[model samples]
Target: MSPFEKFLKQLENVKVIEPTISYDNYVTIDLSDKNPDLNKELLADAEKFEIYIEDYLQKNNALVAFGGYNEVRNLYKRSTIFNGEDFDERNIHIGLDLWTKEGTEVTAALNGNVHSFNFNNSLGDYGPTIILEHLFEEEKFYTLYGHLSLESISNLQIGDEFKKGEKLGTLGNAEVNGGYSPHLHFQIIKNLDQNSGDYPGVCSKNKLDYYLENCPDPNLLLKIN
Candidate 1:
């Protein structure tokens, strides 16, 4: 079997979410799969909306419920409109997300080396990130944990090994965790491409095919309903 296939086989029957939960009542929006020309009018409007949402969340203490990969996402839904163009709906999320109160304990999914780590703090960006590499059946792959607490990567050393179920870190609060609810964006990557603590959690419609192949749905390993 290929590296990716081997990794998936190793994770058979692993419980990604301890308790299953419904994903209803979540405010949903999509980024344009189209390149988003970002003309002056569209760029300005997007910026304003982004700022408004940021402030609103700060004042309301509301969290972003579900992100990264969601099996329930209606892949057939219409693509979002940016400026004037309609893009394809590449919204069938492949990663698994843990949307709950902040400070949730994030455990290592499996025994692996610290492949990479970084602090990505931007609007709609992963606040803090860690990627672990797993070798199974002589094949190698990686798992990425995003939107984690700052301390998560404080003392992490690249290539250091962590066992499955080890305390990888905790979830960060809104101000530091990309101004959203505290949750983990966990993704399985077949190839690293030398990226450290970062991978493309979101992909444009044009590149959906490539991203889908390179980054398969993590549920294949997690199998959490």
Candidate 2:
């Protein structure tokens, strides 16, 4: 197996998010092309989309709705920044999204030092984002936490340390979280490639192979299911 794959296997014993919400309370959500319920019109209205997600969680008796690794979503089509003339559209989600209510507490997935943090305030962006640098078995990697409240990084400095399960921040609302239903975008990046506080959470179909390799499924660590 590849070294990264082996590293993922070791994460089975790790608890990324808090265990207060049991595994059974976490439900998988699909916003990909396979889910017929997710269309341009449905995702266009932020309120309606939020309601849709809440309703789904309520129906499933779940507290958290999570999934979306390598999912090609129609949600970004409205943002020219994502689907602009600059290049091919970047709609394939490279991270795992945990959909929960706004203000829900988020914790660090592993022991790491703060690498960089910033607020990407553009429409359909990550909003307040934080990247942490971690070392496992002598190999270096990165973990990104996005869609966070401004207060999360307000007092944080580069090199600040956080242990696993440490409360890092709270989920931000649409107003502060780049205009979307509240959710935490978590990603495990093999390499930052010189990226700082921000990194592309989504990629185009043409570059799927490279991104898929660089950003592995975070479920490898969360084990939410």
Candidate 3:
């Protein structure tokens, strides 16, 4: 196994989100083409899309929904920033999205220091984002929390410390979270390079290999499944 895989195996007992929300309360969601239920109209309207998610959670008696790591999706086609020819179209999600209600508290998966954060105010983007630097077993890595409310980063500094399972922020709605359903886009990045506050959570097919390597599956840490 890869070093990262071994690292994740070591964290099998760690709790990432709030303890009240158990693994049984977490449901897997598919936004990829494999889910034939999703269509253009359903995904176009933020409110409707959110309702769809809520219905799913209610049916399954789940408190939160999660999935979408390296899955190709059509949800980004609405934004020119993603669909435009500036570069290749970026529709494959490299992050795991935890879908829950707005204002829901988000917590640190492990002890880490605030690395950087910023508001990426653009259509179909992460509104308020934060990145934390972590060191484990002599290896360095980073964690990113995206789609957060503005208040989450209002008083945050570059070096703020957070213990494992400590409150980090709250989920933001479509109005403040780049016009998408309220969700936390969590990713584990091996290299941030010079990027701050934000890194590519999605990539094109051509760059899939690089992203799949840099950003490992967050479930490796969460172990929700």
Candidate 4:
């Protein structure tokens, strides 16, 4: 494994959601094209997609349905933001998504300071996002929290400090969170260039290798499964 990957894997007891919710209450979810239970019919609208999630969680006897790291999804086809001017068709999700109810408390996976935050008020975009800067034994990295409530960043400043598992924000609803089910798009970024507040959570096929390396599986820290 790469050094960053090693650093992430060695970290222990990281939780980005409600601290009270144990990993046992967290169930893995598959929104990829390979999941036979998923289809374009249910993915066209946020309401349908949410119902699908609620059903899955209910079936699994869980509170949170999380997955989607390095997962290719069909939902991005509805948004032009994924398809840049060149029409590269970005569909692979690079961040780990935790699906749950709106207003659910979201926390930091580790001690960090706010690197940036923004309200990317576009369809299929992260409504309210916060990026935290962290350093582990001289290995600097970042953690991004997307699909957050507007109130999350209302008083947040660029360099705000937060300890591990501290309340960083809450999950947003479909109206504000890029018109999707309420969930937290949590990611670990090793090298952030000039981008702040926002980074590409999904990538095109050509850039998949780079993203997968830069943004490794966040489950390494969360250990949800």
Model 1 lDDT on a 0 to 1 scale = 0.63
- TM-score of predicted structure 2: 0.96
- Candidate 1 regions off by >4 Å? 1-3, 6-10, 13-94
What is the lDDT ranking, best to worst? Answer: 4, 3, 2, 1
Winner of 3 and 4 under lDDT = 4
Among residues 3 or more apart in sequence or in different chains, the pairs in candidate 4 whose N, CA or C atoms overlap within 3 Å are none
lDDT of 2 by residue, 1-225 (tens): 577777776775455455577788899998997799987788888899999999999999999999999898988987888997779999999999999999888888888999999999999999999999999778789999999999999999999999888999988999888889999999999989989999999999999999999998888877776
* Tens digit of per-residue lDDT, candidate 1, span 1-225: 555655576665443222223233233333223424323343334334345444444554544333345332322232232112465444445566656556767778788899889888765567898999987567688888888889988998999888777788888876776655566788888777878778867655576667777777765676543
What's each prediction's TM-score?
Answer: 0.66, 0.96, 0.96, 0.96
Judging by lDDT, tell me the better candidate of 1 and 2: 2
Model 4, span 92-194: residue lDDT tens: 9999999999999999999999999999989999999999999977867999999999999999999999999899989999999999999999998989989
Local distance difference test, each candidate = 0.63, 0.89, 0.89, 0.91
User: lDDT for model 3, on a 0 to 1 scale?
Assistant: 0.89
Per-candidate alpha-carbon RMSD to the true structure: 7.9, 1.3, 1.2, 1.2
- Which parts of model 2 have CA positions greater than 4 angstroms off? none
The TM-score ranking, best first, is 4, 3, 2, 1
Runs in model 4 with CA error above 4 Å?
none
Q: Against the correct fold, how does model 1 do in TM-score?
A: 0.66
Q: Which one wins by TM-score: 1 or 2?
A: 2
